[model samples]
Target: MKTFSAFAASKPIASLWDDAQAASMSEPELLLYRSNLLGSDLRITNFGGGNTSGKIDMPDPLTGQTAKVLWVKGSGGDLGSMKIDGFATLYMDKLQALKARYRGLAYEDEMVAMASHCTFNLNPRAASIDTALHAYIPKAHVDHMHPDAVIAIAASEHGEQLTRDIFQGELAWVPWQRPGFDLGVKLGDITRDHPNLKGLVLQNHGLFTWGNTSKECYENTVRVIAQANAWLAERSDVPAFGGAVRAPLDRQARLRVVERLVPSLRGKISGDGASGQRKQGHFDDRAEVLEFVCSQDLAPLAALGTSCPDHFLRTKIYPLVLAFDPERDNLDEVIDGLDGTLEQYREQYRAYYERCKRPNSPAMRDPNAVIYLIPGVGMLSFARDKTTARIASEFYINAINVMREAQRVDRYVGLPEQEAFDIEYWLLEEAKLQRMPKPKSLAGRIALVTGAAGGIGRATAERFLQEGACVLLADIDANALAQAEASLSERFGKDVVASAVTDVTNEVSVQASMAASLTHFGGLDLVVSNAGIASSAPVGDTSLELWNRNMDILATGYFLVARAAYRLLQEQGVGGSIVFVASKNGLVASAGAAAYCTAKAAEIHLARCLALEGAEHGIRVNVVNPDAVIRGSKIWDGKWKEERAATNKIATDDIEDFYRKRSMLKLSVLPEDIAEGVYFFASDLSAKSTGNILNVDAGNAGAFTR
Candidate 1:
């Protein structure tokens, strides 16, 4: 195996402190800046895996006299992306007062509410359980982090000794204890008892460092973690992970395997996603990941589970290792046996829960594994949403680092089983879970929208995003796609939205979009086959090229898009919805526009055909026929508009108003109006309806279906 990273081997964590930058900042801004610098590097700490605090003087609300307050990272906030408001402020005096109310370890949970009462100025952000530890440290600034290098030593059997040896007695070591009121008091006593100690290591936990100022605290934390990394490097002479049991499969080969496995895996895990609350997937096969998954120690280490409290909370107690061998040609067989293998893992999890439940533990969460290790390919992590799924894979990478470094010096150790459970099902943690806002309507749904760079396609993509779906926007125009992607990504985060430059008329291009969807997110749940073209001409004047152009884009493009998405939807085995945006002409005859009318008619028929064939797989296909959508219509841009204006003997600029008057309801349809139709069909609101048509044509009598 490849050992630690080259940068990690060097072990120099240069201080990014700028005196010029720090000179103008107030204490709170400095704390935020210090935190951003620390979280910028994953080597310092994993995302959302650490807390930083600063004590500052602020005037009391009740009285004008100045008072010192503790400002710490709020619950569920990531250090990297948080704003000043993300910090929960509590009066230091009120925090100190809580110590008298502490009823010991058995009643530690009551302290969470007790701490909330200590809030300064009625700050809405909730304080985390780690609040007590920060409050009791007795320092102006404190930083508690779960760095891989530090955790490596923390998880090793000889960690306490290593802490003593490496720090030369400057840093101290505390045995494993869950964080709460008792642990906080103990930490306070330990620091007060040993005034010379700069910081300490908590077994199976993390490092806590303090200083007179925020800068000092930040530097001290980095210095200690750097020392640990260098010390481990000097001793790591042997190959990591028992020298790797098999070589990694090449990239293309691995993706091919992943494309096959992820769909089937997602389908089985989602259990049909009928609730619209399903799992989205993220996969990683980086060098470190490949080394670990292809290693001899993979099984034993994975079974022992993660060590840090933050790590195990995101990833479960153990990962389910798939029965796959990269060296053999047995992928087909392994895929076939996934049901049995997953069942065994589920049974093991059930047994663990049964063995560990206290009188009032929160009922078991989704029994399926969050992390799935495919020996040759890489790691697959799934969660209720895409960003979380990606975060799970990232956290596991940290676990891999911990295992690698611990093995280099001493045998790795995990937390005691019952202790792990206590953290997992803690009542405070359960309350946090309950407090989470309800998920959005399309939360966990993944969709691909063709012609999404502008107009109706763009509108549909935005609609999906607004309701909590990850969208892959596809358009043949690269520039337009880039612009659309930037706008949407800015509105909804970049993680939930991606784009692929695709010409849906090409079979290969359409298939590549599916692969792109799988690569960006796990698999496909919805397909909007909306790419189209419009034309109008007398039969004699309309060239065969014009006829074929309409046929190619409107008819063939829809077919290619449907066929590709159907494969992923079927493989995923989870139910899916496909909404095709045809046109009013699909059902209505028009003068001198036979080619355009026939092509749209064919598009609508295709959806009905797909609705028939897809029913067996629980895939619903429906159509939305939009007419005279002048605003933001890519079809109304040039030739089609002129041809239509001439056909109706109207002026070019008045086409929109003309259509408005033509509709029975006299409504001028906009792209956003058409999007509402797509949303209705794609969402579970239409879960029971299939092979249906919803028209956004402003009461066009010619196109009404009987």
Candidate 2:
């Protein structure tokens, strides 16, 4: 809501932005930095959704002393694709001075002061409005982005209240306001208040936090956003827009509209179009209908915009009106009516602010709604330029869709009016707004592994943790499950692992396990249906109980787990991945193992079916078949072991060699190797792959024998 003058100057900080991009820079260092930033930023936001900055000291030509400058990402640059040039430099001393005087000066004055101090050689590219905030950070590097999940929660009714409840004293909350000096000053003040605070949350705005180093900042951001995301997801009421007609707008038009509106509304926006069209269509006819459509539906449309509050600078709080009519088309009347609609919108916004503000807070200028459209007429968003407007419109549309759906569950609830005010005026959160930390690739991701007490399952859990994923380890054996958790915790730490005693054969147990996984990780992403009982019994001699048990775990268990994962993953909307751990018996027959073979074969087929069914929901399903993994397993200690020894007329020691030499490779396959295959299927590397049955049997099945 804070507006600054266009003529405001930006003062650069000393020792903040100057860094050598010389040829001598280590390739590994460069690659590491780039990859780290890219991965972290991308996870925080969608493609090109966030920004980053680094500070370095340069030798002052006259003083010979190091001066700091900030190298911030330029507008329109994606953190993922940002190069050294993508950053704009600002003097550190000037920036810090601006923060000191920020309380008394108008936002425009602050900007002018800062801009006047830019380096002579630096191209006169407009510094990001958030430059002052970035300068206030003590860290050498900073990254910022509007993560979709985090913003979705922050933009909702009671968002501020919920944030305060979840984060408690850990975070600073800033109210929704335009980004620039006013926001920076407020943030600076708050940061001073909470010296140890890891991050700041702008109510109805995006998140911001920094660290002494890039990795620290990135990790902190991931952890904080994850906390918010988990909290919100738990309380959210996202619904399935079942069999609804997809939006009718062309992709190009959608993007163009978003780009234009983003700067005007000052928010980030992205998502599918169905919701936007539906919301825009709600106000079919009006000269300023575009703005009305963009603005009036702020709560519902929160999802499509930059996830955080500060995005409003790019998109504006609302779009301008084109025209409005419930029934017919009248583009000319709508266009002519823009001025009046805008006036009305401004008046209403001021009234809303006045009604909501506390005695201590200063009132913000009422900006016109970000959207306006007339029925049967094209809609447009007004902003400083087309790109900003387009971004705003896109985000607005997306928010509308979310709002409409949320309405089905509960009338679109947004942050309480007081909470919104607090965030809009929060100084500490604004100060921390310099750069957001990058999110871990797997920060909010969830994984569930059956038979997790076994070596392969445990290994998979460990690997997932290393990649930043939260894991739910499920097993039928209570003692084994407990021990697995203890072992995994010792290796990977406690927060990364959770264990559930699950009997996959039981539908209720499967359901409970999945629910626990969701509760533990906040959402479901990957599932490893690896729990199965192996037995060696010939066809006629196999007990009915044995056959049923085998089928229950290997076949029916897979079906149940897949079904549970699919439901939760679909609810999440991000594509999910699932891997079924079958065995060599699935592909090749073996004597005295009818039930085992049948169960394995059914599991493989079940996975194929799930892959087909899950594709519609963006869930990938695959199978991994491993043969004779013998590391710390009861499979070599129980009845099956005795039976195998008797039937094969050999000691258990020789039995191991017997299975190993049966394969062409004559190599002993380890459980970790199978775990590797599971990882491949569970990650983005195999995004396009599904319905695949990968053989990890040491080439035992032979090469495509006809």
Candidate 3:
């Protein structure tokens, strides 16, 4: 892999980052220059993978004098978008001194604590554990990454020989050693022995390249990767498996199996976290996963360790395989088969843990399989959140591709199971895991809210997030929905909020929203049917258009969302809550508001009917009747507000105060007040209450249920 690159040196660094510390290191900005370009390519290093380092002269804290310092990619920052501060600066001599102490330290020894004492600045985040390895290299710049093409060669059985053939003088090889102080010291030894080498490939791991200039280091990486790709491509005509007849994937049948399999699989693995608490996990069936897992050779190839040792951080060493046939079995048969498969998988995983775990290590990790391979179907990945599930899925798909390419050249081999476990459960990774905050009460639950762009919908969506539920905000107003999503995600987190443009009145649109809910967050637990409009008209004066619009959105929309969400709940075999945002106008007759009143009354009755039918399925359906809540409410906009003011002989601005005094408590009805009612029904606080009507209008006796 000795190909050359045409990369030109970047211009002088400018102050264009949120991190001021990073921008301040503008002179000799080689580290920042190289890191930016390297991080931009996902194929090179994705998410939080890879690190770059440089040697620079800076003032020393202890000596109050100028000294050479090692500035490396900080522990938690992403390289593609890293700023100057992303480079964790440490005095070279101090860091070099700590390396000797790490020689035989126990795996449980705190690497971060030892490195903390060497930091030139008191940055809170820990430095990358590979600091020593970078410092020991005499070159001006070093780049370490797990590029897929490089990993393909490292994972092959003939990887060591292939490295010798491709880049005879430019490259060197290092046998697989779990990354840490020991590995760092070994790398230093390799550098001294082979001073002329341009790069080093770590078997069953990744690649490392160094140069006197940042441009040279960057070019060496690209050229080496391109050579690996070209070499693999030259001999790529080989089939994935040796001459064996294989059956094709039944696409229709596989989809059926996926639909029937996800719910049962979710239930079996729900409570397998370290806390042993029943945390809900999301599922994903990517197109790439289907193309790979559906092949006959998947089970055998995937049974081995991950594409690289570091992948074990997301997808454990190996995946679980299950048998399924849509053509020969019913849902019950599928469930029984999964139960048996899951039990066997659990037994094998526990055995693997006992066999590999070192003494005095942290407790065994959750035994649940992150990736599942089903016969004749696609791969299914599960995790506590959508982002994690997607990460694992993407990694596995890449692994399959890498393994396939490696097999064409020679038999594919990866790090031994024990070594993979060591990396998977390493102390450095454990520290990162320990930092995760405690989960909320409804942390893993998924909620669907209609009319989420405004009024009660927005308020209820925010409330659900506060209680730890991932919410999907649905609304017909695409622009407003996008804004709501951005604001909510900023307040909460992007992973906890998703938005869908949904016309609740249309069956196709509503069904698509339901599918998105499952696709994004695994399952639906709560349905807040709050999307509707208010239309006022007496019997004779009401136009057909106004009447139909009210009925379609207020009445039919509620039915459609509830029906779609309820089916998913039943499939999951887990109880869920459905709350309808009905109106006090439904119970108390309001003249000239026939269409709005009638539609709301119908919505309340629909909730009662659903409650009766869904009771046996552990589904709860309830209603919250809010009266004249004018604040932040789109329902009270335009004609509704004008008409209210005209009726009471007051200014349009006085409409809010009029409704506030209309209630027996004489208190203003805010959107949050109504949201509280929605939350009560959605949470376990109302677990036993169904077919119930909650009056959220302070003291509206006229709208109260008898």
Candidate 4:
């Protein structure tokens, strides 16, 4: 992992612009290049927080005449990853003409709709609310960014005066206003009124700089933010967060406490599935988070909330501070009180909503807090998916910097509840939410698949991810495990895929795998116990050690995985699904395979028992049985194939075809076929069915239940 630094006071934000790299790009390409360079550094901007725009002369399709067009980052586009298509293009003359129809601040939202009428070249990318800010600036290029160093000054009590003192009229100041056409018009007035102004700081919001070219605009932004850092560094005599009231626990001790904390909190924060939506979690125990959480002013500063609109919108207005004592190691005490504490936070959120609701405001959103803080441990953010949770936590880190710096230089201030409510529940924002595509079936679900490096196991993991589940792939083979992880990560995303080399038969390893689930993706939701082996031997030839090996892996491994998953599911209170992969031999007699058949039968029975025990807690346990699944199966890749073929008087290479022809349906079963069965049980489609056996054996009446 890369070292974590929260923008050191002594270190300045440097320019990353390369003139040589910019020489060959067209105007629009340069805009993309400039945006990427600025967005690459977290110190300059948080994810999806800033935007860049350039005015270019492109030929109008109608008359083949050159027209001036405004190209700005589209709504919901991230500068770091966006291509040229991510920009919204509009005719500049049409944008300015809308001013003639503007009624005033009360009609700002209506003006947003008119921007679509001005779309150029049939561009479908929607213009952001900040479009007008870029449009009215009157410069060839405009860069609006949310730099932590600059926002620290903007969030302070004396922000306006500080801007004057630091920039000496080079950068101007605008008071806090919800982003809209009115703010944009006001910015235009400021620049038009003062030609000497280099940029302007939006009070309690962000910074704005403009230039005649993209490179010049990019340089001005970096230079201004760097100068702000230099100014703050010179005044950094005050200790951060009032000089840290408590020290962090040792690494192992912290892990011990967090292992207990996450599952309990995850269940409570998920609202016990009352809302029918469970959240995925992300944990950050890095040094940057520890500095603030262990400080004397953690509570008050966190309560005051974050300043930037981008920060507060991603995170909620404020964070929920979990109660834990580092000195006494009272994690048990903390766990015991999570229920009441969580309920209290919900009540607080609801009350805030009630107080701030407008008649036309969008109905209250999920009332749970997005951020959670533990004094001596770290922070955890929960959202609809893993990436959202991770990004939310990052935005909060930006908030921490804003608050810590603002406090040292002057008193920090967050937006009033009403102002924050207005922006969050704005009609424009509501429309964007409605436009979002529906989430996938397993969107926020997290799963762990054992033997994941093998064919069936890897197939099941991919199926889960395709439905939007974050999966942890566990296996005993290190090399196979690494290969499977890379392949799955390439297909899906690395952010949602995690892997660990785990031996399921061992209690310690099973326990550690559960810990990995918590740390990697908050907590577990589905557990697939599919690890297996094959052996063929007559009753007399089967040794005690051979029978024990079969029983140890097939029976005990399933038991261990189920036992650990049950604890995690119960702790989460969100309930879960556990699917066990046994074999068709468990039901049908296979000659010379007494030990394998007996262990397989034991696995089936154990699942039944677990199903009975888990039902009351909302945990569902099911089983899938496959017959002669040789293709792509790791079991078939070993001597087991030759042993089984010789025992049954069949050629080793033709065993799969022989089994397929012997079946009632004469159809061959593959790993993907088995994966389908597992997916059915793991998803909500089978929510009402439990303790059920699904046979994926291509119709074997010999194994049919009577």
TM-score, one value per model: 0.97, 0.45, 0.86, 0.98
Off by over 4 Å in 2: 1-441, 490-496, 570-573, 645-648, 703-706
Error of model 3, residue 154, in angstroms? 0.8
User: Which regions in candidate 4 have their CA more than 4 angstroms from the true location?
Assistant: 1-5, 9-11, 271-274
Q: Tell me which of candidates 2 and 3 scores higher on TM-score.
A: 3
lDDT, candidates in the order shown = 0.89, 0.60, 0.76, 0.90
| lDDT of each residue in 1-706, candidate 2, tens digit only | 1111101111211121113542345422342354235434332654445556667676666578877867676554566655655566777776776555545534444564455566424546456656766666565766556654445545566656656677886776677665567666677678877788777766555677677665566566767766654554454343322212222233344333333222212211111211111011111212122232334343234423323443443344444433444233243354355446556767766776787766655546334555544222335453322233445555554444334433333344444444444445544334434344554445445689998987788888877877667688999889989998998888876655788899886788887787665333334668999887789877889999999988887888888888877876664455679999888888888789899988998988888888899898788999988887776555665777767766788887786787778777898778788988998899877889999978887786442223
Q: Judge candidate 1 at residue 603 and give its lDDT.
A: 93
Residue-wise lDDT of candidate 4 within 3-26, one digit each (tens)?
Answer: 123455335677788889889999
Model 1 stretches astray by more than 4 angstroms: 1-11, 272-276
Q: For residue 312, give model 3's deviation from the true position in Å.
A: 1.6
Q: How many clashes show up per model?
A: 0, 148, 4, 1
Q: After aligning candidate 4 to the native by TM-score, how far in Å is the CA of 136 from where it should be?
A: 0.4
lDDT of predicted model 2:
0.60
lDDT by residue (tens digit), candidate 3, 393-484: 76776676567667777778967988877777776678778988876666667799999998899999999999888899999999999999
Residue 286 miss distance in model 2 (angstroms): 47
Ranking by lDDT: 4, 1, 3, 2
